[model samples]
Target: MAAVVTALVLLVFLAGYRFYARYVGRTIFKDDDPNFVTPAHEFSDGGDFVPTKRAILFGHHFTSVAGAAPIIGPCVAAYWGWLPALLWVVIGTVFMGAVHDYGALVVSAREKGRSVADIAAKVISPRVRLMFLVFIMVLSWLVLAVFAMAIAGLFMAIPTSVLPVNISIVVAVVMGWLLYKRGVPPLIPSLVALVLLYVFVYLGTKMPISLTDVGLDEAASSQTWIIGLFVYSAVASLLPVWLLLQPRDYVNSHQLVVGLGLLFLGLFVAHPNFDAPAVRMSEEGAPAMFPFLFVTIACGAISGFHGLVASGTTSKQLDSLEDARPIGYGSMLGEGALALASTMAAVAGISLVAACKLPGQGEVLDLSWAVYYDSWAHASGNKAAAFVLGGAAFLGKLGLSPLLAQTLMAVLVISFAATSLDTATRIERLIVAEIGEAVGVKALSNPIVATLVGIVPAYFLATAKISNGAGEAKEVAWALWPVFGASNQMIASLTLLVLALYFWQRKRPILPLLIPMFFVMVVTLISLFMHLVSFWTTKNWTLLAMTVVLVSLLLWMGAESLLAFTRGREQPDSGD
Candidate 1:
């Protein structure tokens, strides 16, 4: 059954890429004419906007958009059952998610590499530009906080991940120097970096490091790790994209393959069945699955965050307009594959654990999944532990030791998370700089100040003392996750809105684009309203205020969109 499911998903994804993606690219976007100027060539700054190979750019784009959200979301959403999450991850990526990402990349490249937020006013209405920018900047803060906490939590969970995660940065910086400064090609440097990275992955299991190794308490150590992460992200974001971001991400991009390849190969060998239910009716006080499930599994399915990456960073580095199909659409498909592996790992991967735990056959399988799921109260933030155990057990089938397999899986998870964490920081810094320039705040225009604006708040939130819903005060998670999910999808829907308008203005058939836009918009609005009520009753002021601002922006943008649509592509939308 596991093998069958895996094969079916692979086949479906291949079909989606081969037919649907190609169809959308050729006709809708009108990319058949390849003679065009890209931002990388037109505005080659040698730093942020240099033309890059699609392979290297794919590394940056894919790893950046696909942090740990795909893992964390499906793992947590196992509360709803694997089927719902799996369906969303697979179907959504091929249709809504890939198109959204591809459209954003293609559109932004056309507009000379502006952010989606930057294009809001032109396509929607003038009032939208500032509100959209603020909304995106706020969303960037949430991204930074969530990923920062995740990486730190993983470090605490797998202390062995620290050495390799940190070492990748050094290797990346060295490779950046060689590739750019010394005129070396990326093939040799990236390959060598990958080997050295895996070597350290093995070494990391042998020489684990944490603040606790010195004198810090566990909580203090987690706090310190979070602080250290932001510091590194701040510096890394301030550096040139090619210097640290590109080489590191290019290497990490390859890591995604080796890591994902192992888990998929393990699935076939282990052949674990679906231990979790097909559809979990309810889970005590869990939020209704309809909207929350969609929001929760954003990255693996369809994420607005990908729009940000596509337009914000990826668009700037697009070497050719034609690469959007492969880089933009293809990268999203890759993320969907990751999500599928995560979903199957959460459900069937329990078989590997059940063989050792329970006595019976039928009930034992179900019980194993329950054991992993029931530990939710204690394991909500570190739910990656479930994926880690299941994946390691899968790897154990291939003759690897439990310890080594666990270490390998942990490194894979953290490597992607760290890549995303810093990439988000870089985007956040750019957003901050944009916000500052718009507001005439010369101090905010400074890269360092702009970074701190987002980073400091993220640090505070990551280390804050908050209720983890079980009355115990755990750190880092269950805070901004809901807000992030809601706003992230909203960004996606809004991007779709912009794309829909772009097509409408050009007199292209827009039904295909509008389908996903309306669907995501309605669901996200419903989810936000529901969460907003909860935030009010609980007096979660930070999230409450953030949600309120986002809702306000949503309403404002909605009004602008209405006017723009009614005005029929003329008259400046009549004094909006």
Candidate 2:
């Protein structure tokens, strides 16, 4: 049954990519433009805007967007059930996420690689564009905060991951130097880098390093990791794309492919039965599946962040407009595949016994569906850890040593988080600079200052302590996760609106884009409302105020978009 389900999901994804995605690209995007000059070639600087091959760009785009969010979201949403999460991921990726990402890429490529918010200024009102940029900045900041703490939490939980995660950065610099500076062919050098990364992975398992081992307690170690991560982000943000960002993401993409392959192989071999319930009742203290499921599993299905990556960086490096389908649409499917694998791991690989055990508990618990769901429903701290534990368990079924398997899983999680952290920081820097230029703040227009402005708030947010209900304090990342989900989906909603308006002005078919736009706005608005109620009940004014602002922005954008639609105003000739 498990094998059949997995096979069906893969088949559906393949069919969608071949038929549906192709249809949307041809009919709606009108993707084949022989005369279209991509920005990478038009603005060739050998720096951030150099033309890149489809494969390398795909690798960079895929890894940047396939962060820990997809894994964590699906794992936590397993509280509702695996079936719902799986269905949403598969279907949403096809109809919603792929469309949004592909549209953003195509539109940005058409507009000289400006971001969606920048494009909004041409298609929508200037006021709408300002609000949209603010929305992107806030969303990117939360992403940086959440992902940094996520990587830190993983480091503390699985100390062996610390070595390989850091070493991969050095390996990326070497790969970049060989490929860009030395003008070496990519295939052999990238392969060599892959081998070197795993060599360190093995070494890390054998001689694990951790701040805790050096005498700091767990809390202190986590803070240290968070500090180190922000410092790395600041440096990475200032570097040329080819130097660190592109090469590092390229390596991480390969890591993702290998890790995903092993996970599916383990699934086929083990064929572990699904242990979690198919659905949870409303009485479980979890929000109903309607809106919550959509927000909870944002990336796997449809994420606004993909749009940022699409227009902000990917579009600038596109070799040709023709490659947008595979790089943009196809990457969303790749992320969906990862989300499905996470669901399988959580549902089948993690046994009830293991889920129920206390931290540091030594006894092995019995495997049962009921016990698994109950324990999973109540598991605490960085739900990503659950997926890591489950993935390690699945690999162990293939006869690997438990310690080795756990270390590999931890490395995978941390690497994904680190890739996202840097990418978000870079995007946030762009947003800050753009905002500064628009508002006449010359000081904030400096790249270094913009990068620091982006990182500092995220750092404080990640390290901020809040009461954990038992008198002890905890990192705010986990507490702010729901807010992140809502904000992320809100961005998706706004991006879709931009795309819809673009299509409307072009006199092309807008139904395909409009449907997803409407669906996402509805889901995001409701999710925010629910969060507002929760915050009000708990007297959490910070989140309450944030929610209010997001809701207001959504309404404001929605009203303006509606008026534009009703007016049927032609797009400015400048946009064309």
Candidate 3:
């Protein structure tokens, strides 16, 4: 019953949203500009501006945005129970996430494929553009740091995932060479690469490798993995899109489909009952569901990060305006479906044994929803581990060997995180270079220099340590997760505000964009305020400062936008 209900809920919303998206594209955005030349075609160099097919570009856009955050957020938010997580993911995706993403794509595409930050200067004011760019840079830094640590943690925790993840990179390079340089058909080569990837998955399960087995302590091993990942990101960021980014993401998209298909099939075959409660009272010292849930489950619902991917990367490669509806709106709903699958796993598969261990309370005796919520809330950086356990349980119920199932699940998570880490680094490099040119910094415009500038700060942050509630030191990524959610949602609100202004300028209906922008602004500000209080109480000065800066930027940009809307000054259009 639970599995059936979950599947139906996702399928229904997806179907309805597909139709709604088409309507919005036709009516509001007037997105069928067949005569309009896309950036890819207009500036067709043999580089980043290559006109891409809808299918390949969709794969890149989807994988780049749908990272481990979606999975981790829903799994943690299940603390309030599946109902709240499910509702928010579905409603937020259709109204908020998809709108934000699609609007960014359409707006950027119309404006010569510039980023939302770049368009902000033309739409609002130069000051707002500077602030927005700074906010995005900081956000990208946090994303890179968090994901790098996440992949490192998984490598150390699930040793079997390391080989397949590394092998996929080589396979991606080969696929890129064949498809782009050699001019081979994409379908057969991509499919063959995916099959070889799974072959590594099987071999990984049988002959798993571990860093600790080579005589390094856990901490040392984790650091080694982080260093290795940053090096990979640096190299990968410098390569041409067709060489690595596009091909790797294309392969990963197939992995996503296969993984989701298997998980859904297991749900039907196993039909696991919902063991977690429907809703639980907020525990002391824990984030409540109202504001925090919206911020917590960001990527599955609405992520400001998606705006960057849509405008920064996807817009530059679109072959036609019609691709925006499917690449932007469709990818977001695909992420929403992933979030729903995560919610089902958290509620149905994870139970007492997989629960969190509360500090100073050796082991929980009751093993109820309260216990699980407390455990998950505190397990910040490692929350994805619980999802892995639950996913493994699902496979076990389908009669797969427990070891193989766990190994496969670990591989899935690691692959997702690695793709996101490198993609983020690439985006950051672009942002850094843009900022350099804006500020007249000559060295910063070089790709190698810009890539180093982005990776260095993230590496320092990832390796930094902070004091936990128990006065013990923990990785900075774990300490920053709460603040990261607020920062991300703040970006989303700002992006929405920009989109609303774009609609107003065009004399189109602005209600749809305005409504979501207002709701997100309120939710995000409240969450940031709550975080301010929490950070101050814990004397966590670093995060307190970050919250202050983020909140200030949001208000500053919000005020500027408000003034523009109220005055109704129609600025001269920058010719596209």
Candidate 4:
């Protein structure tokens, strides 16, 4: 009876969410003109501002924001039970994430297709833009560094995990390069690349590599990978969009859709119940339930990162103002759906007790999944579950065992780190160049010099961070996680502020933005303060360094934003 009621409630909630989003789409995004060509019509010079179809733009926006973090965070949170995690995912997405993502896109589009950085400068102030850019770059670096370590750890842990990712990256790059640079049709090459990637995935699983003997751990290895990745990112971001980010993201977007579909289907069929407590969180937890959940599940709930993607990339591609509603707003709902799907999977599959048993183990074990399957098998007393378990047991025969899955999962976990790292480097370089021009630093204006200055310092810092850790093989996950969460939530809160400002400017009800803004900010600030206090007491230099960067950046952003608003009110506006 309990299970039936729970299932029914979930069904209704998901159904309503989908319906509401669909209604939003029809009313706001449907195009009346049959002759309307998107990127073809709006502007066609193969630059940043080229327009695109709403559907394709939605693809871009969704893919950029959706990644492995959703899977990991929800799975971790599921240790408490599905109820709280699911609740937050739904509420945060509908109220917080969707609002920020959609609003950013609309606001950016209406302003003649400027990047968020530029928009911040105009709508807020230049100081705000500068501070926001710095924060973003730093946040980007942190993300990339952490993930690089994760990916490298996976490679060292089980070399076979590298097969699918490497093959996928290569296929994506080649396909994108051919399509955009050589004038080849994207459809054919993309399909071929995807097919090849899948083939590699299967083969890679069938034949795996073992690297446990390697000295590198998840933490140390990710730092090494970050250094290398940053150098590559520096080169990649500077290149034409078609070369790397777009094409790779295009392939990634499709994989995301397919992967998510398969994952959800499998979970639904399984329909496993979580065995964790309704409120299993500890008061002394580094990332405690209340505030930490908000940051950890940012994209799945409300990510500030989405705003950057919407304004920086997607808005420039919008064909009309109306398309913004669906592509921007609808994609957010889709991401929320994805988060819910993952949360459901975690809850349905894993037992809570097994998940809780991990921190004591002192390693990032693949606990959630193992427990879920084991429990379901125990409950049903099914031979099919036994076979699956046995298959996992023998996975080591091909080196495609549980360890390999962890390695692969960890690698995939940090893919965003690479994306954010070099992306940050480029943004920083741009800022430095702008500063140079502003202050008349003749040598600083040189792109080459600015690029070096930006990439070189971060590279060294990343290397030091990895080496200073407890051990080369021991991944330092606990220390940095809180800061990462706080940074992401801070961004989400800032975005909501932007939304509130926009509505306020137009004299519309600001509740939509204000409410979410307040919720995220309060939660995130609590998290930040807790993190700072914890690190300060411990005198952990590495954590202290990261906390300092985060606090300083956030403080500057706040001051700049307040001053901008004050200045705006003081100046005589077009509307008295």
Q: How many residue pairs clash in each candidate?
A: 0, 0, 0, 7
Question: Least lDDT summed over 10 consecutive residues: which range in candidate 4?
Answer: 379-388
- Residue-level lDDT tens digits of model 2 in 1-576: 665798899899899899998998987787787668899999988766978878788889999899998898887777777789898998899999989999999999998999888898877788888898888887787789888888887787777888888889998998889888899888887888888888888888888888887899988898888899999988997888898888888888888899888888888887877777777754455568788888888998999999998998899999988999999999999999989988887777777224334334455556444444454345433376557777887787777777788888888878877888888888888889899988989998888999998998888778887753334565665566676787787788778888888877877787888888888888888888888888888777766776788788878877876777776657544434
Answer with 1 or 2, whichever has the higher lDDT.
Answer: 2
Against the hidden reference, what TM-scores do the models get? 0.94, 0.95, 0.95, 0.77
State the local distance difference test value for candidate 3. Answer: 0.81
Rank by TM-score, descending? 2, 3, 1, 4
Cα deviation in Å at residue 244, candidate 2? Answer: 1.2
In model 1, where do residues sit more than 4 Å from their true spots?
354-367, 375-382, 466-477, 536-545, 570-576
Which consecutive 10 residues in model 2 have the weakest lDDT in total?
352-361
Instruction: Give lDDT tens digits, candidate 4, residues 87-189.
Output: 7887877766776777787666656555566667776667676677667656655554454444454455445556776666677678666866697866677
- In model 3, what are the clashing residue pairs, if there are any? none
Candidate 3 per-residue C-alpha lDDT over 1-576 given as tens digits, one digit per residue, 9 for 90 to 100:
668778787776677566878777876777887777888888877666778888899889998898999988987888877788888998899888998999899888888788888988877888887788778887888898888888887887777888889999999999999998899989999999999998998888877889899899988998999999999999987887888889898999899888877877888887877777778756775667789888888899999999999888888899999889999998998888878878877787665223434323566444333444555445343477557777777777777776677777877777777877888888888888778877889898899999998899888879998775447786676677777777788788888888888778877777778888889889988988988888789887777887788788888998998888875646435432
